[model samples]
Target: MQIKHAGCYRVAVVMVLGMLACHTNTRPPVPGWPEHFGFGKTATARQIDSLNISIAPDGKGLPAGSGNAVAGKAIYLAKCAACHGETGAEPTPNRLVATLHDTARTKTIGNYWPYATTVFDYIRRAMPFNAPGSLTDEEVYSLTAFLLYRNEIISDTLQLNAVNLPLIEMPARKYYVNDDRHGGNEVK
Candidate 1:
């Protein structure tokens, strides 16, 4: 009986050790070479900097530059026309302009966007669908101005800049209500 008890103790110890040694995390693999993976390299600062950029609705993250709608027209024709059409009057769902009204607004920039700076931010980060994030700050400002002008929200000669972009209010600004979500046991 003593010998059998000793053998059972040894077996229990071995099982616990085995379980501890084989434990693993169940989450998806991180972006690094695991113990068995030896092919990929760690991400560099430059690569991270270029890819990790976001802009807020209050004109934050806007690059320094200025451009008028007149100049933007040329750039738009060359890079944006394929997707947005020449006059922003395309039959697309998010058409930039045409027959704007309070009840019949088409959700275009002039009608729906609350801040003009958002226009610049979106264009700078993602435009020219084929090649995004390649345009200079000047180009983005120009495009923003052009879109504003096409919707008759701004004059064709008005130059847009970081300083003034945030001040231009959209027609539908009164309709949007900010999210009052706060963390915890409360539901927004």
Candidate 2:
């Protein structure tokens, strides 16, 4: 009986050691990796500036350029009309404008987006569908103006600038509101 008890104790010790070793062996390697092994270099200020062209609701980060709906029409026809249709009333993938205020609406610049400056920001970062981030600051401003005017949010002559861009209230602002949900279970 004493011999059988000693053999059982040895088996238990062996199993514990085996489990510990298995756990220790499965740890991940050190964080640092060489550049050749798919690691990217640190981005410089200029590189980051080019990539992070985000605009705030207050027209912050707007470039030193200005344009109006008139100028935007030409650019829109040449570059945007193909995908967005003649008057932006016919978006290929998604409907942008409904000509006038349509009760049944999808996400569009006029009735869906909450801010006007977002129009410029979105165009500057990703637009023309085929070639994103290609339009100049002036071109982006022009497109913003055009979209706003087409949606009847602005007149045809209003020159969209950093100052004026923020002032133009979007129709969809009433729908959007700050997130009021707390971290707890309440989802309000």
Candidate 3:
């Protein structure tokens, strides 16, 4: 009985030691960087262009089609009025148009956006806040048209798209100038 008890104790001790040994404090080695970061393959220009829809400030990548402010008003009431309000007043606290105080005082679309193309560009990228990039090109154009019209920047009958978008000049266009500062004691 004593011999059997001693053998059991030895076995239990060995098991515990084995478990302790198995639990090491070492971490695995970090993975090395890839040799070719997946840019060796060339896609067709058409294929690349399909994915790239960014429009420049000069209206470079704008699609064909036009929308008038009158048309835009209906679309705005349907899709945007809930958030941006009936007159872009922002009843829910997201002002799409500037207040009277904002005009000629600070940077609102009506006050300081340099070009109308920016409005179209921004709406094309992000608008309707909750549902971004969901508007059709015509819908975006219409929204831009409506906002511009509401701001009294353009007439309701005016059509807006790529070709005509750049033509609608912003009131604050002349005030902006490039920052000439470089990194030294002064910041650029």
lDDT digits (tens) for residues 74-126 of candidate 3: 98998888877788855345566763445334346776688788888888788
Off by over 4 Å in 2: 1-51, 180-188
Candidate 3: pairs in clash: none
Ordering by lDDT:
2, 3, 1
Sort order, TM-score high to low? 3, 2, 1
Which of the two candidates, 1 or 3, achieves a greater TM-score against the reference? Answer: 3
Strongest candidate by TM-score: 3
Clashing residue pairs in candidate 2, if any? none
lDDT of each: 0.76, 0.79, 0.77
**Alpha-carbon shift of residue 33 in model 3 (angstroms):** 16
lDDT of 2 at 156: 89
Cα displacement (Å) at residue 116, model 3 = 1.1
Residue 50 lDDT in model 1?
A: 65
Could you give candidate 2's per-residue lDDT for residues 65-163 as a string of tens digits?
Answer: 789999999999999888788888874665567433676456788778888888888787778889997899889889889889988899989878877
Error of 1 at 72 (Å): 0.4
Q: Which candidate would rank higher by TM-score, 1 or 2?
A: 2
